[model samples]
Target: MHRNHELYEYLMKNSWQMTEDWYKQVDDPDPNSLYSTTDEHIINTLKEQNQDYFKRLHKIFIEQEEVFLKEFEEWTIELAKDQKHLDTAVHYVVREFNKTQEVYISYLQKFYKENQDKVKLEQFFLWLEIVRKTFQLSIYIYMEEAQKNTSKQIAAQKEMINELSSPVIMLQNNVGLLPLIGDIDTARAKLILENTLTQCASLDVQYLCIDLSGVAIIDTMVAHEIFQLINALKLLGITSTLSGIRPEIAQTAIQLGLDFNSVRTTASLANSLAAFNQ
Candidate 1:
């Protein structure tokens, strides 16, 4: 139900040729990129994907624009999420997209030249606009999905780091050590609370020695979170002993009116360990 049926058929029939032509021109010197891969299987698969992409692109000339775009976007999103493409630098992938668009435009021009008597210059320009817009939409969708996947991976990595940073290492039967170091932001404090509780419960720790010797600063909110963690552990029947509480931290706790009298305290990790291990 399209006026450009002849052009659509022409492109569909030559999809493979377009893919081959596109790949032959690929000249990326970057050794880290999939574009420069020497693997035969990957090269073949890349050509297949490119051909499939062109086939879908040509459908826009024949199918309803809405239908074509919805299908095309799905393909682009899946390609964006592909590990090979994700591992490759984004700029390289986008450059390939630009090159592919040029292939389509070149093919369209060829078609126009062969049918100059039937295809007006204005009609050719209109088709060129459609080609450019479709490529733009595809690129936008790909970049958006790629960013979302990258963000998800980063968040997962950050969670892992938070978990590792707040580890509760078992030193003896029913005893564990949580060495607090560096800055304790509110976010990290909350993570510490959750991770500590889970680790303590899993390790069946009865006494947890929280060493704060390396920590140089603690804000009011973070200090509150630490207290909450202590109380939470208390509810779990785990006794928490504060060790190496720095002078500045103690001063902050005093200013905030925090009651550390309820929990046992030690001047250093060694003293706490000796007391708990005894």
Candidate 2:
């Protein structure tokens, strides 16, 4: 009976000590009902009961460690299947996980420096996996947000192109000011021609100015089109003046052998307007 009491006391003391150690290691005391807490408590109790019991507990712990390590190795292999040529978010997650493993290894080295206990290493390895999984989840969230932002920007650009391609502003009768915005693609050119021709016909403006100040570049096709439009306006008995041709464009025009015969060119809209008024 005395032996039984002594064994009970020793078991309780050892269980309490194990709990304290676990708390110190994790720094957070889980509810005693938690699986981890319950497992540790049971193991501690069994180990303190008899010498054979302690040996059995150690063997069980080793088995559990082996299973966990196998799982961990498989998880790591799956995560790093295609890290090198990773183009998508999944690949990016793999790469980040691989990077996190390096950090995890460093942490393990730091913690196991003095103790060199296999049990401690196993525990820490499990903890490291928990951290890695959490980090991977966070990276997935970040990638989702990045993809959303990219999609939004693409949608906005499409809307902007639609607005620019389809005429957003109506020309007032007798108003000759045409402010061009953005790159002058073929669609934009057609829109400009339609608007300008309509305005000229309806407004009966004697002097028409084609402003090119906002134009970034004038390729051969653009120059040829402009020349054709100018000749057509002349046939309609209207004088067309080209304004705001940059020196670079002038050079390109000369190089491309584009002739602007009898089509008046000016440095600015102000100069063109002054010439028209004269």
Candidate 3:
């Protein structure tokens, strides 16, 4: 009975609960204790009395094992996923460190005694230093990569803002320069107009120059936008000059019949600046 109590306590600590029959099975009569039944007979009676409890305990044990196995499998999968990048970094570090270790070992073997004890401590210290240095180097490489990625992202964001803002590049005090680059869609054209107008008002410039050397061709929508820009600039009391008229663009503008009669035109940026100076 005492042994049964201890076992029950141990089982409860390990998250195993028993049925009511458990107590009845361990408290039966025994002939060995100067009673009517024999000890074996008492034990057999207990087993018979608690058959259902034993069966339930067996089922619980099986379920607990299954639960532990499932959790272990899940943990393994998560660890595998998390370690992929770390594993690559470790591989790189190990490969580079091994090469350094080989060179150092070769150099040491030539000067040191050949016995294991003679160089074991020195080799251990050397390997420890190599590991420390390798860890530092790996950290440095990771930091460098992170910095480069951050720089690229910042640069991209700035460029996007500049593009959306349609920043006007002022060339000289007299010349209000707007160097058109890349494809100029209708939205971009509107941005260009707004930026130009803001710059013209702030600078109080008399001549506004539009350089189209970077532009490939003129479409109808872009041509109309250009015409609108000319009108908007005229209302702001600033004269707008067009430059870098590629022959293909000029031909396209003519085919589209984009009305540019009110705006002055030039062949090159240099020519426009020259005309402004005069």
Candidate 4:
């Protein structure tokens, strides 16, 4: 009890110098790291944030574990959301975080040496436990935030790829051409249906030339979904023409009792478009 109070007082007195030294040690002015930014205002803000963290960390020794954890969680949540840390690798921050543990350990060891009678052996173990728990929470928050950010990025990229792959070219006024050039998985097929309908409506395409020249194969479910798109366009007062149906794919559709009699189809995209408005 007495050792805790004395150590708290000693830490409070040395907090400013400790914070400054810690900042100096971790400071990476290489312009690559989020903290060691070149901008004067950014550098100052990072320094302030670093100092605040050190102050709060030292207070953990004096405060209740629950209270400190609540505050630390809040601080780290902000750190996780910060664009600076998001731009940098978590491993970089991990390296810097390790330095802090080393620095504080050195401080604890020095305190133990000078006041051997005042500091109990239990205090060292207890302090290590607190540091370990706090870092565990920090690591969890960083990983969770990074994972969420990566998921969002991947979703955005997928959406972009869907849009690019299923392009509706304005081959003529009131006429559009959607050329499916790659493998049509179930997901991409669904995207094609949605994008086709949306683009047809938004672009005011009276007729859509769906060219499947690039597609070598498709499943029955995929062929059904595509025909469903055609049916949908028909209800919308729009005409849809299927072109460049590969022999194997057409046979698969026929074998599945799929009929193209209800919809117009051509052997080639050029022939389909050439027959447009004639």
Specify the highest-TM-score model's number. Answer: 1
lDDT of each: 0.91, 0.53, 0.56, 0.79
Tens-digit lDDT string for candidate 3 (1-278): 01123322333443222333233233324323311234576445434423332333223223454563455344323322332223333334234334433433333343334344544655545534543443344345544554455566678776587565455655566567778877887767877777778877887766788888889877998888888888888888877888997888878878888676777889899999898878
TM-score for model 1?
0.90
Name the lDDT value of residue 256 in candidate 2.
Answer: 92
TM-scores of all predicted structures: 0.90, 0.39, 0.42, 0.78
Q: What is the lDDT of residue 10 in candidate 3?
A: 36
Residue pairs whose backbone atoms clash in candidate 3: 31-37
lDDT of 2 by residue, 1-278 (tens): 01123223433444444334333333213343221244666545423332322222222223454564455444434433322212234543344334434543444445456346433556556645654554564355445554565576678776567455434132233325555555676655665676566767777766677777877788777776677777777887877788898787788888998887678888898887777777
So what's the TM-score on candidate 3?
0.42
Clash number by candidate, in order: 0, 0, 1, 0
Say which prediction, candidate 2 or candidate 3, comes out ahead on TM-score: 3
Model 4: lDDT of residue 135? 70
lDDT of 3: 0.56
The regions of model 3 sitting more than 4 angstroms off are 1-165, 171-173
Query: What are the per-residue Cα lDDT tens digits for candidate 4 across 30-62?
Result: 567776666788767766776677777777777
Pull out the clashing pairs in model 4: none
* After superposition, candidate 4 runs with Cα above 4 Å error: 1-52, 87-93, 247-261
